[model samples]
Target: MAPPAQSPESDLTLPIRPGDKPPVPLPTRPTMIRGFTLACPVCGTRGLFRRWVNMVERCPTCHLRFERIEGHWLGSLSINTVVSAVTLLALVTVAMVVTHADPPIPLLLGVCSAVAVVLPVLLFPFTRTIWSAVDLLSRPLAPGEVDPRYDPQELAALAAERAERDRAGDGSGSGLSDPGPRTRRSDEPRPPRSSRPHDR
Candidate 1:
């Protein structure tokens, strides 16, 4: 299907390409906040999630490997837990403080229970994305970590990278530079001159 046309005035004119390298994430604060909006931290695009909590395996725009690895999202569990704990505590604290530290037990119980159930579920996607951003930033995607579809391109990029590294003396050893055009005499063992024929 054809994409919808964009007006020239639209932000579409902006340059936001992620480049060939693994995503260079924005600063830490912006990165984490991007998660709350369910934006792909790599490209700042909100098309990463298919549903509220249903994340696409890979980013549609930059093709970043979202999961990165199996069970990598376990970090989000910590994010959710911490956020949930803080939320529940904050709510409880406010209720008690408002009621002179003696808020009704039933009211507190009901409210906390409801908030606990709803907050986690509602924020699951956010925490997961947030965690993903943190993880991505901490472990900048290397060439080998890219999606399989990008292997050819990444391999080329990697080769270029290694070449540059070798040039810069970052590799184990530098490559020998070409010594100009080869002279046949210098390049090959001169065949024994046909001494007998030449003598004639």
Candidate 2:
């Protein structure tokens, strides 16, 4: 049998049509970086984190999972490490350039070590959020994406239908036929209407 018609406001269960494209183009490295800075994949919005160092459950606007998969942030850690190393190297280079000589070896090593250790902690959360947005943009929707809540009316209708079916002797069909008490037909009732005058 064909699937039952969905309520008008209910979510679409079928796949999006082939020709229907997203309004924005698929994300690239630059776009992904921008998403990370904005804290949302689709639109650049602030407040991506609900608490300090903790990602929001989902993007406020796009609803993309902030942490798409467990351990996905490890990629961000790698990126952070590379960036921090590059930054320290550049700073050391700039210092050597300005002074026309390298700093003392011990001093240079201490500075580099301090930066390398501290930089990752400072950049870690931002990198992770950005990585997640990029990953979400690159992926196809997963099976059975659903909103957590349903319309009140639809829920009420379903409840009423279930209750009516339960009240009927057999709930095999639509339950529209009113099965009288003791499985008798309403047309076969012999009691005078006056005896149930209060029902009016």
Alpha carbon lDDT of each predicted model? 0.76, 0.65
lDDT of 1: 0.76
Best by lDDT: 1
- Residue 69 in candidate 1 has what lDDT? 82
Give every collision pair in model 1.
none
**Per-residue lDDT over 71-150 for candidate 2, one digit per residue giving the tens place of the 0 to 100 score:** 87787778888899889989899879877885677878898889988888788777876676556556633422212222
Steric overlap count per candidate: 0, 0
Residue range with the least summed lDDT across 10 consecutive positions in model 2 = 143-152
Which regions of candidate 1 are displaced past 4 Å? 1-30, 144-200
Shift in Å, residue 68, candidate 2: 1.9
Alpha carbon deviation, residue 121, candidate 1 (Å)? 1.4
